[model samples]
Target: MAEKKYKKIVLAYSGGLDTSVLIPWLKETYGCEVIAVSGDVGQGTELDGLEEKALKTGASKLYIEDLKKEFVEEYIIPTVKAGAAYENYLLGTSFARPLIAKRIVEIAKKEGADAICHGCTGKGNDQVRFELAIKAFAPQMDVIAPWRFWELNSREKEIAYAEAHNIPLKITKETNYSKDKNLWHLSHEGLDLEDPANEAPVNKPGFLELGVSPEQAPDQPAYVTIHFEKGVPTSVNGEAMDCETVIQTLNKLGGENGCGLLDVVENRLVGMKSRGVYETPGGTILYKAHEKLEEITLDKETQHYKQQLALKFAELVYNGQWYTPLRKAMSAFVDSTQETVTGDVKLKLYKGNIIPASVTSPYSLYSSEMATFDEDDCYEQGDSAGFISLFGLPIKVRAMNDEALAEKTGTHFPSVE
Candidate 1:
């Protein structure tokens, strides 16, 4: 292979197996100074000893930036408010990648790096997300995807390469699950989850990180009230907490109640189906609460339309189109709809069940007098005759045409009956 004359490269490092190996590989391959950047999006203690590890491996400098508050307030909150879930999978990993890539690009520019590198495999969705985010921010910078260029095809191969180069790693042959975690969620893939026929080891003790299984949850149900102000969760169980603390508190409560566990076989951006288990305890609660609040506050048309927009929003987030114009436009619409979505939602969590107990909002469009069965001054029962006739006119005309055709042809034609 011919040598490239790149001076410096910025890597979106996680201090994980793939990134740990990438530090040395990039230096050896391109002879560039590697600057490792690890964004802290509520991965908790996972950032510990990361700087030393990156430097010890091969990186010239390591940047562990605190991105938790920004991630929650900017990315996670808007996504939750937009109700963006990709095929019922909470976009925990999807949304975090763009932010991480954006930060890496920032660091790359600051260091005057020639290229940016990421640990995302060629076959996975993160590659697309990271690349798209990078392109959005810095289109001229070269992207070095080592997974595409390197001969390390599998975990075993990568481990072999690491061992041969005297590079230390945490992964071993016994490690089955490939996991990604942040403040919003923890995702598990590979291993037993790779097979569609295999059931998730939810019954196992250590299978879950954010929460416990429904069976392992307490027998009694847990009730909690969530308050929302303009679609953002302000308080949980009447306690006002910051973005970080609120999510953490709800993660504990929702996990104990067996909430926010999902098993999905989703179509990946790479055109393959992948199965994974996601634990999003706090996110689940917020989703349910936001939905309930919207139910009462938003009018029928806006509420229904926003529900449709949410699917697209989910797709954009999942595909890493976070910085695109369409996402921004959709978020504007979502924010407009959320202006009146201030309210409280009461829910009962039991054995992984999120049961809506009650929902109340001062801006609620629901009127008791309008929908009552009893005689009321607000609504007249006799008005329904004209309203029904006007509403059913298209169907009535079609049925009439069918009847005339049947009579004329001396054959039975399908009617609206």
Candidate 2:
């Protein structure tokens, strides 16, 4: 056993296999008091019996803070409004880690802990996310990452340690898949999914918790109308609701119709690529609806620039830099662009599809009079002659220079082989 390093340590616990074992391991290795902190970010039944389990496993105390509202209003909605989709990932787990870790820091400071410990493996992105948030909030606190230097290197070994400690864990090799759940999404990784060659078991009955496969979805399509107020979704089907209720309603509606299922082999912030499947039922609907609303609301240049900024925003969030200045600045800019983004978007949710049905906004940029093909007083067809000439000037100039060079060298510059 290692010598004592901290007298009291706050753990970002999830009641999972890794954290379940870390409780006893920390006490035995350092003779420290473990205060487990679990942030309730709409994980539903996953929090069952967490208090009993934490105390039974050697934790001095456990704090379960409800962060669902903050998570949706602050983290999830901003990303959704900004359209930050990273290579098809909705960034469910990526953003949740920082929020959970930030709460752990708050609890740590409240309890006057000497250090913070986590169950994140050295190979994954959560370690980076947790530590960065901790550093941002409490730079002086130490982070004890056991996976970086521990004897229990593998999941099998950790199970053995749990068994030796007489701890109860309802996990088996066949069903052991690393998962993260919150209001926004549910992610499944590890197990057979680690092998990219193997297809995701999307159709399996018990594989997906938040949603279903396209084949299992009902044949009839469902339609949902989302209302946005300055880029944030405010209502569903014309029924006004809070942010949390709005997401909950959409998750059920979208899930039943097989709307939001994604399997991606994405690049991780740890300098490696990993495969994972996600069920983002509500988030998927909101993204599509918000995108459709933006189309009719934002000007072409602002919309185009926001799209580019979204990629960088996604990277910052994925890389665990949520507390950074650049992220805040970008969000401010996105909020500015959303000033006129109030609208209603109707969508048809079929099997694995979110098709735009209709969109309307008070500040719509689309002008039917100016864009009509038939005779219209708002626009003149003859103006295109001058517009085309100015637009193609660079191309015309380049071609003229090429022709002159061809004539001088007695060669065919426009020759095609």
Candidate 3:
């Protein structure tokens, strides 16, 4: 069959090994012009020289977008407010993918591209995220997933293909971890992490980027005061900051105090289990503080039900169902519950421990006057008898019925003694 042809394709390029090789591969394989697009979701210096590199590697052009603020405000904040954590692993990578992919789709539409491309593997959740976003926004655009169709299967093969094609590469076959970094978190998969039983070598010099290991952290704890308004973090250490500044500040403080490191073997959306390690120093602090604030502000029933909603939200995000109606509905519910969650939570961060020092909110349901051991006139001491009797009526009736049955049958009931 004749090779498939595309006039123009917008590639979600990271200037990484796969994407670098993809530029020329797409040009050659599909006979199309490739425009590489990279989202700056706060990978820091890793994005440097990406444009020149992409152009040098045969991309017609490169669009490097700064999405840090939008990512935090629109994506990270909602996930945080919902307290969405997939099996104790914060949805850092999961949360960022949809935004990045959405950007890619927008660029594709603006560039009049026939298709959008991504470096996501078939087995990973990112492919679902990228394609779903594309389908959501631009249903007419085709998706070119190279890993799905390409002959190169291993890092070794990719390196050889890159060398043969003279593609510039900073990634090598021996690259230890398959990582995805954004303002929200840094995730490490592959390498030693592929084995569930193998302990992550956190002691290794280059293993961690966002924070230190708990053992290497300082013995002295660090105290931070976080202020939230309607469930969104507004300040850290009593100083008001924008979303970027707040996250950056907290990342530094929490990293120093050994916060936000997680390792887990998770069930992938593709019906496989994968092991990964994540560093989310700032996110951990924000989540802990927000949770504390909710404790003081939210009523018991709302808190309990919201906890259940949070689990579903986490699953939706992790499964790449961000644009779905169910997630939006859940977010609405989460937002409504956050109205009274405005407050300040003081936390003691010590060696990976996020201990709540104090929580205060104007809407706090806790009443010291009513809860105190030293009695006040408002307390009705005699009300307990009726409450207990009514509450235990079922048990009392069951016991009496059992006794009556035993007497009628002339047989001893087990509990009669």
Candidate that would win on TM-score: 2
> Candidate 1: where are CA atoms >4 Å away?
415-417
Better candidate number, 1 or 2, judged by TM-score: 2
TM-score for each of the candidates: 0.97, 0.98, 0.95
C-alpha root-mean-square deviation, candidate 2? 1.4
Candidate 3's C-alpha lDDT?
A: 0.88
Evaluate model 1: give its TM-score. Answer: 0.97
Structure candidate 3, residue pairs in collision: none
lDDT of 1 by residue, 1-417 (tens): 425668899999998878988988888787879999999998987888898888999899999889999999989999999998999998999999999999999999999999998888988999999999999999999998878777887888887887887777666766747899998899999887999899899888788988899989999999999988899888888899887787998899998888999999999988999999999998999899899888889988998898999999999999989999999999899888889998889999999999999999889998988888888898777899999999999998998998899889998887644
Instruction: Evaluate all candidate structures by whole-model CA lDDT and list the values in order.
Output: 0.89, 0.92, 0.88
Stretches of model 3 off by over 4 angstroms after superposition? 1-3, 405-417
In model 2, the runs with Cα more than 4 Å from the true position are 1-4, 414-417
Summed backbone clashes in each candidate are 0, 0, 0
lDDT of 2 by residue, 279-339 (tens): 9999999999999999989888999999999999999999999999999999999999999
Candidate order (TM-score):
2, 1, 3
lDDT at residue 16 of model 2 (Cα atoms): 92
